[model samples]
Target: MNNNSTGGLPVAETCNERITSPTSNLGPQFTLVVLVLLAILMVLLALITVFGNGLVILAFLVNKNLRHRSNYFFLNLAISDFLVGAFCIPLYIPYILTGKWIFGRLLCKLWLVVDYLMCTASAFNIVLISYDRFVSVTKAVTYRIQQGITSNTIARMVSVWVFAFLLYAPAIIIWEHVAGCSIVPDGECYVEFYYTWYFLLCASVFEFFIPCISVAYFNMHIYWDIKKRKRNRLRSTVSISKRVSVPSKGNGQPSRVSFLLKKEIPSLDLETEDGLSTSSRTQTPPQVMDCSHLSTTSGNDRSAALKVKTRSKLHKDKQIAKSLAIIVSVFAICWAPYSLLMILRAACHGECVYEFLYEITFWLLWLNSSVNPFLYPLCHVRFRKAFMKILCPKRLAVLPPSSQSSLREPN
Candidate 1:
């Protein structure tokens, strides 16, 4: 057996090196222990992925507030992850342990197609997620995304699934549709199709490389926009404070001229009993001015309300953008090594496809699928609250007020 490690896991294949076989070097006890550990890990991963993505979907179904235009992408992603957890990861365990595809020819081909389909769909969904966040962050000030999101949402979801299917179509075409080359040996159930090079190239390029570049580009733009918005807000606050702090000529009172310029002169600016201009009434205490009435001015109130609303919206959008950026980053990290290995395997032409390394990389990809649910709690208070409401309503009922603080959006 050859040696290759992915994510610190040793991958060894057995027998003729075509499929996995046990090592002669490691004793049976050690191998059994390893197998048991791998089984436990795989089962645990699959369970968490199913349960977590289920919660994400449940949150969407129940929480009307979360059923927004942007969140539709999340729903799509959850579905794809659920498929990965339920369909892809579990089938892998037996193959790895037994070193053969004992599941028969038809089922093996079916498994290969489903595995490729779900994994491709998951990748495409992430691309959609990045695109959605980028649009939200870039166009929030200009567009009522909510008004037009239905059409956009439908189009995106359809496109993601369709394109994902197309990306993996070559595999199905070569292994099943092509008449002469589609045959698998008797009792074998692996993905050792005829077009390994083309399959690996297409899979790596479309699923990994292109998506990685798109995610990085979109997130960079979103990040830059957030910084620009924060800078503008800081400048506005500083300008307001400076304007408010200006004192008239040697008196400790703030300038009436500045306040008048800002608020269009309150009713108190009218001629006093002494008939002096409002600015000349230095002896009058600034507190005497009816700032409350000025604050209530329709134009001023609207302006302040607009500023507050805009600030809050920007804050929320930025938080969401950051959360999605983390998700994208996690996806890249999890999938990169797998993509690399795919390229290597293609280059080696099946000579170096280590069972253990492939499994390690495969699990890493699933890790991304499983992590989405946990990320919601880490980045968004609303999702955390929604999750708790679904998972443990009784526990949340007696939840400490301080614990609610955990729901705050991360910095």
Candidate 2:
């Protein structure tokens, strides 16, 4: 066994001894199988996450259409994913295989910090994207003017990095080395459970709870607004029908339906109209129709359609947010059991009957990190398109002018 001192912990041992050490108590066959499986999974996950996130970044950078303020959040998210895969996975896979943290004290702490920070950043980015979408859809005019692509993009990028660093700062301050031999005799590093919990709680709040609430609330508001708008539209249509059905001024000529049709219906101004405006406007022109009147009616119809589309888009966003929330929540839920079991084991200095369950939970948590990239593509159309473009570039190539002009433009 090898040994070195850093923050009061022992290190320096042969890799094979670390793997087969009696301290680990893992049989040769079992240990070999676990290591093999972990290696395979890590390799696969690293490739997927790296390539998936890389495609997202490439899409944003290369496509002028995608280089908008709203997409900045996604760019940050992609960066977070890439960092996690590059920095976290390589270190973690070795540790898992060796069953010990052979890396030095500094590296261990740094890895822990990076892992937490990147994961938090990723979650926060998703929340920001949801919020941006909400604003763009609900208050589109304001979004276009006040929160344009450049300013909002820079602000969000800065905020994500700043928040990530702040979130991880506590870990650096609180982390301390604890004495333990890893499953691999050669692997040894500080394990700071106290700081781990702190990090987890902070991450859970910023990453999971806050985003979940913000997305859900906005989506609910959008839904309610849509329903209200639909009702108002139906009422307007009924009123217009009633007006059209009314007989012409006692002329007994079938009430000249064309004349009524030519008359412009009052515009439905949801933003400006109050109860008083409705009452006051009752005395306005009852028959005169002008182009401006037609334009207003057309504008209201467009606005109503836009609201419906916004509501639909928000509903999809809500589902994606909910799915991500569930992913994080399930991670916490699944991991909590084992963490508690380990804590009990440490405190009581006794064996726990739920070792099997603990192992299952730990593996499940690992699976969470592995599966997120795949889930993202399924939940997001942009990500899906990016993935397809990456996988089959020729298929996504721009068409000739004749074909291109015919394709519906992106809003």
C-alpha lDDT values of all predictions: 0.65, 0.54
* Tens digit per residue, CA lDDT, model 1, 195-307: 25655776689899999899888888888877876676566544545444443444444356456534432221222222232333323456674433322244344335435
- Angstrom error of the Cα, residue 369, model 1: value is 1.3
Q: Model 2 compared with the native: what TM-score?
A: 0.66
Which candidate number maximizes TM-score? 1
Clashing pairs in 2: 2-12, 2-13, 18-184, 18-185, 248-255
Write down the RMSD of all candidates, one decimal each.
10.2, 7.9
Candidate 2, RMSD to the unseen true structure: 7.9
The regions of model 1 sitting more than 4 angstroms off are 1-30, 173-176, 192-195, 242-314, 352-355, 398-411
